[model samples]
Every structure is written in structure tokens, then in C-alpha cells.
Target: MIDKDRDTKKLQWNIGTGVHYTLNANWALQADWKYNYHRNTGARDRLWGTRLIYRFGEGNKYI
Candidate 1:
């Protein structure tokens, strides 16, 4: 279940950048950084995160 009113009237901002490189013929590595901002109920929050990804196949994926 979901609440529409609770989901609405909220403001958020997000920015992200990522890079990928092949470490070997069968593997690749990726890194990413993200920043997020949320405002609600007269309060504001800023969050950031970093992620590292490894792939077994030819293509790399990140989140």
C-alpha cells in the first residue's frame, strides 16, 4: 500500500556521477558518488553516498 498525500508535497534534489574502467578482460570496476536533498515539515536533510561496483560480464552497471 501507498499513500499519495504522504508522497506528495515533498521536494527533493539529487545529483550523481559515475565512472567505469576495465580491470581485466573478464572484470570491470565502477565508482559513483551521489548527493540528495530532501525538504519536508519545515526540515531539510542532505545525504550523500559512494558506491563501488564489480561486474563479471563485459558491461558494467552501477547504482
Candidate 2:
């Protein structure tokens, strides 16, 4: 069961950051992190992620 009023009125804070680096014209890398804290429930959450990107076709068209 879930309480709609409590869920909607809950207090929380979230911080997030990410970075992107171009390895080359067609390749790139990215990483991210996030932190969440819930004041009402005393809950904490953390998330970390990474990504690899690639572009097709000719040279760098997104100069």
C-alpha cells in the first residue's frame, strides 16, 4: 500500500553531476553520479553510471 498524500508532500533533495569526454571524432565517453536524500523517510540513495558513445558517417559533423 502507498499513501498518496505523504508521497506527494515528502521532502527530498537530489544532487547530480556528469562529464563527457571526446576520445576522438567518432568516439566518446561519459560518466555520471547522483545522490538523493529523503528528509521525511531518512532514506539515502546513490547512483553511478557510465556510457560509451559512437557516431557514424563521415568525420566530426558536430564541431
lDDT against the true structure, per candidate, is 0.61, 0.90
- Which regions of candidate 1 are displaced past 4 Å? 1-8, 41-63
TM-score of each predicted structure versus truth:
0.51, 0.74
Tell me the spans in candidate 2 whose CA falls farther than 4 Å from its real position. 1-8
Q: Could you say which candidate leads in TM-score?
A: 2
- The lowest-lDDT stretch of 10 consecutive residues in candidate 2 is 1-10
What does the lDDT come to for candidate 2? 0.90
Clash pairs (backbone) in predicted model 1: none
- Tens-digit lDDT track of model 1 for 1-63: 368777776787777777777765556566677676666654444444444545566644542
After best superposition, candidate 1 residue 63: deviation in angstroms? 23
In model 2, how large is the Cα lDDT of residue 11? Answer: 87
